[model samples]
Target: MIRKLAFLIILVGLGFAGVGGWQLWHGSVKQHETMKKAQALTVTKKDPVKYKDWDPIKGETIGILYIPRLDKKLGIVEGTSPDQLEKGVGHYKSSALPGKNDQVVLSGHRDTVFRHFGEIQKGDDISVDLPYGTYTYVVDHMKIVDKDDRTIIHSTKPKEELVLTTCYPFSYIGDAPKRYIIYAYPKKK
Candidate 1:
């Protein structure tokens, strides 16, 4: 009776594990499709967005991002706050949108998605090619800050800076004490 009972338990456990795996895979596929569709240009139907009209309201979820220096291409999530982490890239609804003169702040997972950032070099070219036109940026500086610094999100004096933030010490086990910030300046024509 003991042997039979043990086998039954193992079989039930395996069934649960299979169900969990399926759920994860299914959720990931759905999120990917949503992000892909979000990245698709919806504003093209409207008038062109002027660099002058750039404002925080323009912040929107991005589909794909390319960094030449890191040799990384991945999807971008907006709304980096704790809540938005579950869905794809969540845009910082309050921060200035990309291509604007102000800070275009973006964040993502360092381990799984944008991990190549660890290999980024200064003077590297980072570009975001949206459905509209290509927005180019040149990496200027990279700094690691303490995680509590809410001040970093404020608009810069010049408003032409872009800051990308992620956890520091890439492999940190728990919450990261510091944040790795990459500053990039928009490249003009």
Candidate 2:
């Protein structure tokens, strides 16, 4: 019985490993292809009035985000739904878009798309490719907060900021209780 149990455990472990490996490989490939496409995209200048009238559908590809520090690229979807997150990062619909006012909030699954987020530094550059134009942001700070923290989402003052959120302890398995927040501001000339 003990030998059979051991064999079963090994099988389960192997299954998990296979799935994890496939996810990593597939996500990386998709990101690379997406990044190439993003670089070639061109859009009109962003106008605040046009954004206000825009309607977004869940799971729709909204933009592309590139983090030069991590050499990572990911597609930004419209909503933070489970299905959307599986493909890439999700943009908070309530927040402003890339070239608009207020904070543009983006969220991603830590184990997958945001695995290298922990390595980001204050001076790192992050670029967003939107339907309007490409905007660049420089990381300013990072913080860990409770999962339920509302301060991360709500802005206090009028500012053009980009906020990236993911599960804390980037490598943690299962549902993480804490949130990791990266605050970035528009790059200055």
lDDT of 1 by residue, 1-189 (tens): 999999999999999999978865764674566456555643243334543453323334554567876676555555665535444444566676665557777776565445666788778888765544566788888888888988888877566777777888898876878899888888867
Per residue, candidate 2 scores C-alpha lDDT tens digits across 1-189 of 999999999999999999989978887676555455445543455554666667667766777898998897787878887766776888988887876667899999988889878999999999998776788999999999998898788752477999999998777778899999999999997
Model 1 vs. true fold: TM: 0.71
- Report, for every candidate in turn, its global Cα lDDT versus the true structure: 0.66, 0.82
Which residue pairs does candidate 1 place in steric collision? 77-89, 77-90, 78-89, 78-90, 78-91, 79-90, 79-91, 101-159, 101-160, 102-159
**TM-score, every prediction:** 0.71, 0.83
Ten contiguous residues with the weakest lDDT in model 2: 34-43
At residue 99, candidate 1 shows an lDDT of 52
